[model samples]
Target: MNRDPSGGACAAEQLVEAGVRPTRPRLAIMEAIRTGATRHLTPEAFHRELADGGVHLSLATVYNTLNHFSEVGLLRRVGFGDRSYYCTNAAEHHHFYDEATGRLEDIPGAQPQVVCLPEAPPGMEIDGVEVIVKLRRSRQYPR
Candidate 1:
């Protein structure tokens, strides 16, 4: 619907653009992920949605496609500790997580504080920072 006249090929086209094969399962999963306004998605949640649509894409396929997208920089993984979440990489400046509701929100133009160590005893390199801002609803009610 992005106005590509190819017809039934936009999703597949995006796949190829992301350096992935334009396969049926990948296209279908991509549609499912792009259904909502929010770009964030988890493979588990995506699998459930696909199942609801009667699509029999294996979980392995789902994970693989997600990884493929991630590898190609079309998607990004968001998580805290060990819980993993997924999001499209249109703009991944930052994120916010609601502890009470389990919801994830994108934060635009955020720069986190990065402190440097005094010395490195061995060979090591530091990657970019991944900040997870956890938030919760205040218990006290207004009114």
Candidate 2:
């Protein structure tokens, strides 16, 4: 982990390593996401977090920054229906989404092997595969 002058961990160095210029808002956003308890966060949730910390960034800025981070390989964007969540783990992996809580949790270890994929068009090729297993409480066993 990288540390700031005050000896506290910060995301500035990681941002630079990811080829992103670390600005104040960017740093704050990165730090919040990196150190936050939740592994995945939506743009609106991120905005609220920053506001709670007294950072006061606009929702547009939060959305743009998260997208920029995804483009630069610093984060990964996972879509579920009409909502999108930003994940700090950018590596290829699968996830388990809880329908009851709307939480996304990383599936440990390597990605599962996929079989018998259809060939891509003449000019295109499949790049990667992402699997999301949705979970909900069983009706037979209420929580």
Candidate 3:
């Protein structure tokens, strides 16, 4: 899928393909997420961005839209501490989170090898694994 946010047509088509209605608010929210300087954003941050872009959406609306998108596989919802971040790239992948800056970046092409795992309980199965590597500047080599 095209990652460029400028491609509104692509986003609209994606929304439809994900079985979601391509409404104005949904389209705008998707575009904002795709076009954001940072690909990962919290609902509060998204609300601020949409408001700044003149796409006045309620905070509740933004949260609900993001959750819906995540549910439809249009986005990925990642949890960090007490907050949740919506990632535009829904593909299964790892991430590096900078604790100091609260920034989350994709760990490109690096899928950690999981050698073994305990068997799941009866009637349950392991769905997927998510790895989040936390990073912090060392005092000796602070940036």
Give the per-residue lDDT of model 3 (tens digit) for 28-113.
Answer: 98777776454887899879988988999899999999999989887788986797988887888878999988999888875777
Comparing 1 with 2 on TM-score, the higher-scoring candidate is 2
- Candidate 3 deviant stretches above 4 angstroms: 5-9
Judge candidate 3 against the unseen true structure and give its global Cα lDDT, from 0 to 1. 0.83
Estimate the overall C-alpha local distance difference test score of candidate 1: 0.71
lDDT of 1 at 133: 84
Best by lDDT: 3
> Cα RMSD (Å) between model 2 and the true structure?
3.9
- The global C-alpha lDDT for each of the candidates, from Candidate 1 onward, is 0.71, 0.82, 0.83
Identify the leading candidate in terms of TM-score: 3
**CA lDDT, candidate 3, residue 83:** 75
- What ranking emerges by TM-score with the best candidate at the front? 3, 2, 1
lDDT of 2 by residue, 51-92 (tens): 999899999999999999988887789986998998777777
- Model 3 TM-score, all chains together: 0.86
Residue pairs in candidate 3 whose N, alpha carbon or C atoms collide under 3 angstroms? none
Cα lDDT tens digits for candidate 1, 40-106: 7778888888899988888889988887777776677776766777776445467888887677777
- Candidates 2 and 3, the one with greater lDDT: 3
